[model samples]
Target: MIEQVTVTPIAPPPAVPRASTWAAELRATFTLAWPLVIAQLAQNALTTTDVIMTGWLGPEFLAAGTLASTFLMPFLVGGMGIVGAVAPLVAQARGARDIKAVRRVVRQGMWASIVIAALLVPILWQIKPIFAALGQNPDTTLMAEQYIQIGVWMLFPALAIIALRSLLSAFDSTRIILLITIGGVLFNALVNYALIFGNFGFPRLELRGSAVATVLTNLLMFGLMLTYVLRHRRFKRFNIMIRFWKPDWPRFREIFRIGTPIGLTVLSEVGLFTAAALLMGLLGTDEIAAHAVALQCASMAFMVPLGLGTAATVRVGVAYGRKDAEGVRKAGWTAFALGTGFMTLTCILFLTAGPLIVSWFLDPRSPANANALGLAATFLVVAGFFQIVDGAQVVAAHALRGLSDTKVPMIMAIIGYWFIGLPIAYVLGLVLDWRGVGIWLGLAAGLGIVAVVLVARFAMRKRLGLMAGLG
Candidate 1:
């Protein structure tokens, strides 16, 4: 009895000050998102700078670079989507405080990148002949080939960097990605000036120079990101170099299972735009130029919500991992609201300042200026409606991805874009002769359908306890 009286109870650990649920989510999302937004803006600015500097050389240079970029975009964009599979997986692991799983996911993602790059290089190498066969002008074909040859070589390093960056983003270390990206863009700008113009004793490579600059910048970014990851204390013990090289079968299967649908979903949507551009090219150079300008403007606007969508992925992933159904619901709705509000503001700007915006990309006195401005303005008006829907769809898609329900979204995209959007665009633009505007209407329909479907999917997943394993 005297010995038993000696026992004493220990106090429990103090509870974390509960962050205001909505406010916490917003803060976390923005903390992760703003850096990405800045990085995207910087990247866009660098591209704009390249175009501006190249514009001095004449329209042929601009056209050549545009064609090259367009040809290469599906791979780059689709690869980015494929690599995106790492983020939600790692984010969930982080929420569960399972650093080992996060490390495994990163390693698997690198392996996926290698596989994707291997497949991409040969296909991209052969695309020049395809473009030529498609009836591009000889001069445009030659320039595009030259540029794409160099650009394709960058895919390996770019994919690697993307994989690493996705892992870091899942850990909420977005600032590192931002810093590296901005630095890379700055370096690219300098290199572009030196290479494109034959400055500082460099050879006058012109468009070829642009490709080289882009490749060099990508290499630099990859090197820096790798170095940073290796030195990071949390990651230093993982031995990712060996692990990634070894290829864990289980992790690879999981990534491929989740990643393929995402890849196809992105490919379908991006392919739609690429197809539209190609069809527009058939109309004439002026139409192509106008479409390019309008697309560039729309892409820039799309990035804002894309950043928000990425943030939503992390938010939803963490919430799901914590087994907080309410938190997941709130995260999705909050992301939607934020994305819609930002897009609405952009819509107003596009409506009121469409001409001014178009002028930034084209010289008002040029031969194609009128066509570019008029079509760009029309595209912007249509984009105003679609951008909001686009934002909603992307955010909803990410929310579902956090729940690991990628297949449904992928199927929806296939139906919405291929079965619905492409047919409508072809009929309205080619058969009915509505041209560029008709193509845009088709895009709007597909995106609107996707938006509705994705939201519905997320709701269903929530009701079904998709995050059951998260707890």
Candidate 2:
């Protein structure tokens, strides 16, 4: 009775909004995306450097690197796709302020990446025999085998790095990834010098040396990223490091639920391209060589929008977390606009300076260069048309990912690539004898169709309130 007059303290209210949600979404999207874009650019530069250095060895070495990369690519690219499953999931968890779910996702993603690397390494290791069975030249096969074997070892580290990057991206800390990628590229260049040419008192290993350099650099990157994440104050708060060491079955299952379809979707697209290369090889070495050059160039261009797409996912995820459907729509459209603008500019550059660009990797003055350059130029021109559409599609896909609708996009990709795209490419490239250009045209068709369908699906979902809680 005597203490009845005691007063209870009231808690302060949450901070009021400072800006329009659309404005906030735009700022956050760029803040998250620019670093990722820079990181992607650096990674591409690393591969470009490898190609440039190998170009010095002669066409056979360059061709071997290209072939080996294409064959080994599904492991790395496809694995990254699987890891990509983590981002949207983490993003949504972050939005919900569910610290537990976030930590669980990080751990499960690490495990999934390990499994992916394990399954892929053996398949890549035995690729030499497969190439031989496919009638690849003995010289190309020998060089490719050496490169593939060493490169395959790097898959473990690459997968780890990819897993780390995806988690970081979800947290909107892309600067860390950018910094590490820049370091990796520089390290790769130095290692390549020492290993490829026997510098620094090391034995010259040539092509195999290049592979060794790549493996060492990737391992270094993974170590550095892991160390940084563990020590960083920001990341430590989320227990990303701790949870990564402990297995969480429920979280792992959630990751698989979201990730498997994405992995298969990516696998299907990459498989189609790989199949195209194999079929092109059947046509002749020159065709294969030309295809390799064009493919490399296109891959480089594709990374720009790919980075944008990553940013789009983060933006959409953040918006979804805020439970703002309108914000999500605005962010998605803004990303599409930015991506399309960048890719359209790229198209103009490719049209005007394609020959110059191809010459950087392939010497037109060389006797074997004429055909390759000529065909590459043609492919680049055709590639120009699709780049914008490709960017749009990727951004749209990311929007869907933010909505946690991975299954739908996966289905669309499967239909777009296999049911629609690959058949068209085969008919044109092989049956009608349109060659590499034909294959590219088919790719354009598939990507365009995907762009339309995915964007429409996202629109429908938003309009129908299907994305209410997913915000």
Best by lDDT: 2
lDDT of 1 by residue, 1-471 (tens): 000111122231222122357888777677878887777666676667666666656667776777788888888878877888888787666655565666777888888888898899899888668987887777777887888888898888888887787777766788888898889888998999999999999999999999999889888999999999998975676557764467567777778778788888988898888888777767766666667777777777777777777777887776765566677777777887888788888878878888888787778887746775677788877777787888888888888887777887899999999899888988998999999888888888888898898887777774566656433
Model 2 score (lDDT):
0.78
Candidate 2, residues 1-471, lDDT tens digits: the string is: 000111232231222122266667667667778888888889987888788788777767877887788798766877887778778776666655566666667778888888888988888988778999988787888889889878888888887787788778877678889999999999999989888889999999989999998999899999999988888976776566663467677767766777777777777778778877777776666667677766777778778778888888776776676576776787788788878889999889888888888788777888877887787788888888888888888888888787777887889899998899889998998899898888888888888888899888877985655575443
- What's each prediction's TM-score? 0.92, 0.92
In candidate 2 the C-alpha lDDT for residue 423 amounts to: 91
List residue ranges in candidate 1 displaced over 4 A. Answer: 1-20, 468-471
Q: What is the C-alpha lDDT of each candidate?
A: 0.77, 0.78
- Stretches off by above 4 angstroms in model 2 are 1-23, 243-245, 463-465, 468-471
